[model samples]
Target chain A: MKISLNKKILDKNEECAMQNSEFFADNDILCLNVISSPGSGKTTILSQTIRDLTGEIKIAVIEGDIRTDIDAKKIRAAGASAVQIETKGSCHLSAQQVTGALMAIPAAGMDVIFIENVGNLVCPSDFVLGEDLRVVVLSVPEGDDKPIKYPGTFAKADVILINKIDLIDYIDFSLERVIADIRVVNDKAEILQLSATTGEGMENWYNWLRSKITQ
Target chain B: MHETMVAQSIFESIQQLTNEHNARAVEATISCGQFNPINDEVLNFAFDLIAKGTPCEGMKLNIKHIPLSASCKQCGVRFDYDVYKPGCPDCNSMEFDFKEDAPLLLEEIELEPN
Candidate 1:
């Protein structure tokens, strides 16, 4: 009997991602997977979010990076519990790693768990990690052509954060073009334009976030 | 630097196969999907490090390029991928269910005598 080994090898990741989601649901914790290119202001957005919602919503973070405890430290300094998971060299964070990190934090006390994935636009989208929402960050500097260039990331995202709007005037990005392209792939995703540096569209982002957790 | 993971994983698989086969060196032939900014030079450098002096000492590496393919889920139209011209040619709808870059992967290795 010839068995299909190759198919399972390629698909094990997605299966594990689903299992991780079930684990989070059982614990009654809403997880979020944040995906972005390097320096797209993920750490900055997270730092700001942690500051804005710290004690009000007992948060815990499991930071995934190829290397660095910097994000976890920032979240820690923001006055929330944090853990850093170094992928050693993997481009994306696997569900096994996320589930392992979840065990370290007390599930009962935590209202939300944010999995700040490795700074990658493509691979992270393919992996789930049991997130209640998959948020993708695309800064103005990354250009308006990104959604078209990297469709998989845009398609996988539930919310698209067009961050660093303060630099919009300086950059040659067309907000309309970006939205138009994103709408082509994603019809239901909410696009919020904001700057973590300036706190422009953060209110809407916070509301979108809160609504998900409450629901 | 940030490109096809299928290629990256192929490089990893070759280094492992060389060791498991107890080959003195590996002769890898891989079909690289599309012509993106994947630095073959950098991949070779990485592969060298990953396969150094283990079972595979000196190997000839080869990479073949393939183009991107996409099929729109809306009108069910399929075509070769165009980065700048993303919308479906027939429908003119940017809502094409375009597939990301992926090579039709086939790995072949030369083994030394056990």
Candidate 2:
């Protein structure tokens, strides 16, 4: 006989994500899950944002890496509490892992928490860690066709940041094409162009982030 | 890939369901939407690998592909389209609101009394 279950296969993870979401909501923490490819400057962006908004906003980071805590150390250096989750070989961060990381950090009185997901455009998009916003970073070096190529990730982005804009003149990246492509995949994603290293156009990002915190 | 994790979850769900029903699963059906970037072959292979030595071994895994449906912003026409090439069928407008339901689902399972 055939039994109709009709359950979500990822329900275990989804349930955990819901719990995390409730935790954030109860604490009034604005959680952001950041996803990107290997060299898309996710760490640099978070570090810069932490440094820029150090006093005004209390930001903590849960850094996900395959094996190391290098990014977490950088986040600590930038003056925010950081908890590193080494996934070992997993390509994505699960909600259960985030729960452990959340317990490790002193989450009291924090205005915002950023979950820096594993550097994988595909896997990280599939797993939700109870974040209020999903940020997908596409560097100028990653090409303009990334939105269409990785529609699963781009389509779900709350905000898309085109990092490495300072190298736009030297690289063959098309800013207009990228924006148009992002529109095709996700019409509602707020697109921002900035250089994390050079600090150009970062004020817009900071403003947007601040506005989100207030709301 | 992420499919490995998904497959492991599927295995655990099947194990739990079978245990509750006091039977063994012989076949299973899953539904995946266009928005979900799951490769069926990879998912099947991973499932088989994980199911080995378990009661779910040799179970037939059937996957159903669900296309995403969207409503046009300009013409107000609803249609199904690929996520990669998203556009309205009637108005050809790129602007649309996707009406996709749950992307991945374990729909049913065929069981045998053990």
Candidate 3:
């Protein structure tokens, strides 16, 4: 017998993502999903962002990693309620995992919630965690051709952060080329260059976050 | 790998369809966009692992890769863009909307009557 079952394989994940989106909207919380390759300084940028926005806005974090709670601990030390989701060996955090993490953290009174997805340019782009904005970070050391190589992630990004700008003089990273390449795939995404370590160009990032919250 | 998760979802859907029809699945056909970033070889491997001891055991997995099509915003030319370099070929515009297409889809299933 031939069975015609034209269904979406990711329908389950999409359902959970929609539920999470509704929850975030009902609570008036701006949720951001931060994704990047490993060693792209996502945790450092997140920690610094947390510290910078601590007094101004209530913040929380759900850290997704394949192993260890190190990043979650850092987020906690940065003075925000943090939940660490260790995915065992999974490369990305699914919407179901984000929903589970949301129950552990206090949702109300939080102006912003950041879901730091697993460090991967490929798999993480496929999963939507019901975030208001999807941010992808590419550090200066990772070269400017990343957007071309990993178009899926860059195309889905609401904001693209070129981090570690302080190392540009030492490395061969070109901001112009990176922006041009990113524009090819994602013209609508806001591109901002920042050095999370040196705090340079971070004010724009902060302002962007604030504007999102206000909107 | 995330392919494992995707394969599991595919297997589950196949199992449900087979059960609903009271038939044994012989094969399943899946379609994915070129930009989906899934390796078909890895997905088949994962499917085998997840199908063990099930009715779908040893079932063949057929995957059809669909090219990404988009219209150039500036030139209004609709063309199939390469997944690696998704820029508009004629106008070289990166700002274009992707044509409506499913990223991953279970298009059909072949089954043996019980």
Off by over 4 Å in 3: B73-76, B86-97
lDDT (Cα, 0-100) at A59 in candidate 2: 94
CA RMSD of all predictions? 5.2, 1.6, 1.9
lDDT of 1 by residue, A129-160 (tens): 77888889999998998888887688668999
**Which of the two candidates, 1 or 3, achieves a greater DockQ against the reference?**
3
DockQ of each: 0.12, 0.74, 0.68
Choose the strongest candidate by DockQ: 2
Question: Residue A23 in model 2: shift from native, Å?
Answer: 1.2
In model 1, what lDDT does residue B59 have? 66
The C-alpha stretches of model 2 lying farther than 4 A from their native spots are B74-77, B88-92
Indicate the residue-level lDDT of A81 in model 3.
Answer: 93
Ranking by lDDT: 2, 3, 1
- Score residue B29 of candidate 2 by CA lDDT: 93
Q: Please, what are the lDDT tens digits per residue for candidate 2 over residues B1-114?
A: 378888998899899978887888899998987768578899989999999988799999998888777788899998877776667877788787777544788999998988
- What range of 10 consecutive residues in model 2 chain A has the weakest lDDT sum? A178-187
On a 0 to 1 DockQ scale, where is model 3?
A: 0.68
User: For this target, which candidate reaches the highest lDDT against the unseen true structure?
Assistant: 2
Question: What are the per-residue Cα lDDT tens digits for candidate 3 across A1-215?
Answer: 77777788888998999999999999999999999999999989989988887789999999999999999999999889999999999899999999999989997779999999999998998888889999999999999889998888888899999999999999987788899888777778999999999999999999999999999
